[model samples]
Every structure is written in C-alpha cells, then in structure tokens.
Target: MFITLVTLLEEVKDILKLHGQMLNTLLKNDSMPIMAIPDGVVFPLANVEDVIAMNEKCSDPEFMSAVVAMVGDIGGSSLEDATRRMMKFLMVPELQRHNELAATFNTHSQSCAIKHRQQDTLEVLDLSYNLLEENPALLGGLEKLSTLILDFNNYNSHVKFPYMPSLTALWLNKNKISNLPIIVEEICSKFPNIRFLSMMNNEAAPSYFNGGSLTQYVDYREYVISQIPSLEVLDDTEVQEKERELARKTYRMQRIREGSRKRKELHR
Candidate 1:
C-alpha cells in the first residue's frame, strides 16, 4: 500500500500521521521496520488495517452474529473466514440454549427465592446432569446470577460462555473437558469475577478421583490460581495466599514472554 503511494510526501504524511512529528528529532535515526516503528504496530500495513477493522466490529457484539448468518450462505470458505465456522459447528443452536435453560430452571423454580428469573432475581442455578454443550449468550439475561453448576455435562475446550460478571462460583465436574489452557482462557474471559471454580473429574483438571497423580493436581491448581487472581477456591481446595504468591511467581516470567508473543501477532 505504501509503495502504491508513488509520491515521497505521501509516505512521509503516513508516517507523520502515526507519529505526529517524531521525524523532527529522529531525522537521522528513522531507520526502523514499519512494525517496530510507532506505538504497537505489530503488523505490516494491510494486516494491521484488518486487525483494526475487526476490533471495530467486535465493539458491536451483534455484528459478528450477523456475519455468521451471512457467511453460512458461502460453503468451503478459507480458514480466515470471520464466521468462525468450526466454532459455530461445535456450538448447539440458539434455540437449544433456551431449551437447556428451561429444562434446568423453569418459571415455577423461581417462586422459592427468586422471581423475574431471567433478570436480577436468580442467583444460583444448577444446570447439572443435563448433557449440556453450549452456554449461550441468552444466559446473560440472568443479570444477578452468582453460582452456575454444570456438573456432568458435555463441555469441552471449545466452550464459549456468556459474559456473567456477577457469577463467582462455577462447577464443571465430571465433564469431557481437556486442553487446560484453552478451557481456562474461555472461563476467565466469560467469568472475570469468578471466585470459586471447579473443573474436577475432567482430564484437564486431573485429581486422585480422576485417576491423576497428586503432582498433576497440585500443578493444575497452581496454574488455575495463577491465571485467575480473584479465584478464592479451585476444585474444592482453598487458594491460600502463599500458594497464590508461588503460582504468580512461577508464571510471571512466562506470562511476560507470552504477552510479547501476542503483541508480535497482528491479532490477539
């Protein structure tokens, strides 16, 4: 794109747009790669533009849904199709999300303590033993829901949950989840305020009950606690201050390296 400009002033104008007037002091020291130049310019021209466009699109949540709907009309798309075809394939239908919620908690279930069940009344919802798969965005309607239990469900590494800031406790015992990092990333993203979380009996969260070694269990707990600083308890074990400190100390350097790598990539 810069080469297509043809004029020298146009290229200079583009650099000035990024760095204002940095060229004034650094006239002789302006030899830098476009990516390593101003700010966090990790990508070269076209790729960075796409990243900016995607970020803008992400600001509107409904835009991606609309993209998925539109993209479904085209088959045999490339790996970079914005629809996330593989992820869409893994998730159950939107109607299924409603069906699962209805199956677990109905209008009558709310009479005991909560009302306006979809709004702020509901706090604890146990959707255990329901052969669940998708935790749809519809669950976000329960604004005040705190604890969500999905024990013995079909959740895996690909689980994409709705953002529930109020939720603190989550149980996913006896599930098919593996690939610890992927599942942990999804969990932390969706439930930023989670305090008590359990992924016991899954391959990712190995334990004595799950036929995994004691060393593996300790490692899992430390990793999880490190990833989620707000986590008070993991799997039934309390996250002590000493353990948390050790976990952070252990992963801090690794986290820094990962951050650098992510910055190098055009998209996060």
Candidate 2:
C-alpha cells in the first residue's frame, strides 16, 4: 500500500510536468511559422514550408479549432490595401476548412461573396494587436460571425462594422480614435444580441504631455459605457469578488487596531 501511494504521487508529478512542457511548446514563438493570408492561408510569402506543415498537422478532425495567420503588413501601407490583399486570400476555399480560427494579428481580410451576399460560413475571427489604421469595409461579409475580436488597432479613419447580424463579442481597445464612430451606434441599434463590447484606451496623448490626466481617462470610460448598452464586459476592467473581500477585511482590521489603541490610552 505504501509503495502504491508513492508511485501514484510520482506519476501525478510527471503528468503535471508533461502538461507544462506541452503548454510551453504551444506558446513558443518559434514553434509555429509566421505567414500572411493573401500569400496563403497557412503561410505568407516567406513561410510556405511552415504552411504545408501546419495543414498536415491540423488536418486531423479531432482538433476542434486551429489558428492561422491572415495577413501581415509587410509594406505598412494604408489599411485599405492590407484589407484588399487579405480579402483576396480568404477567397480560397482551402483556407476556410475550419469554421473557427484564431487569426494572426492585423489581418484585414474580407470576403467578397459575403460582401455581395453570396456565401457565409465564417463563425469566429480574432484579429487583435494589429494597429489597424482603417476599419475594414468587409466586416459586412461575416453573416455568421458570433465573436469578432479587433483589439489594439489604431485606426485614424472611420471604418464601419455593419451586416454582422450574429455578432456577440467585439473588442476595440488601445486605438488612436478620439471619437466613437456613428456607425457603431447604428450597429448597437441594429444588433440587439451583442453582449460583450470593449472600447478602452482610445485617447491620444497631447504632443507635450507625459501622462494622461484623471479627468481625460474617466471621460473616455464614461463615453464607452454610455454608448454601448448591450456591452457586458467594458474595457477589461472587472472587479473580482476576492479583491473586494480582502479590502473589506483590511478595513475592519485597521478599525479594530485603532479602537484597541484608544482603549489602552484611556486606561493609561
């Protein structure tokens, strides 16, 4: 019995270590090859070999979802150009094998048929941290998209997000936007199902300023909450119950200590 218990503990430790190593491998930057969508669904212009390997590995139907790179701005041109190329690549049927995909950063890929109301199967798309300069016009193409994550893109121009009737989650954070586009209001009015919306840190600092003022930050926060009614999560700002309980406990402790000290002084 003692020997069995010791062996079980060792086995559990080995399993945990194996799980940690697998997680590290999955998150490693060099593990997966980086590629662009217009170039290919799996690989951009440079990493065709990686794309092939990804396709072979991901072809297994057991895996529910797989991530792929959409487009990377090699030229760093206007958002319109980036989106155009992205759309061109998405047209390929081979790329859309998985209904769910976590895309690489800054893929402005659009669907022409969806734009024209021909076909629709796109369910999930995550394009975060691309520093997008324009809102892609192709958002209208995603008829079945339930979750759309377009966070950390700095767009100077007004890009519209319309025609996604099934959208639930939309993430728009860390942009250079000073004004919330009117189209966003229209989206709220049109789509009553939207549950999660985030538009945080859109304020641009003044040319000479070292830090943003409290007033400026609050104003932006208030504006976003007020604008989106269906929003469940706002600006990634959530107060955990644990933190609140801890604060309450700390306050009670301080009060008790103060009261004890006062009583001792009175006795003295």
Tens digits of per-residue lDDT, candidate 1, 55-149, equal: 45534546534433332322223222212322233223442244432453322222312222345587877655445676445577788889987
| Model 1, runs deviating above 4 Å | 1-118, 256-268
* lDDT at 33, model 2: 38
Measured by lDDT, the strongest candidate is 1
The 10-residue segment of model 1 with minimum total lDDT is: 1-10
Cα TM-score of candidate 2: 0.42
TM-scores, all candidates, are 0.53, 0.42
- Model 2 deviation from native, Cα RMSD in Å: 19.0
lDDT (Cα, 0-100) at 216 in candidate 2: 60
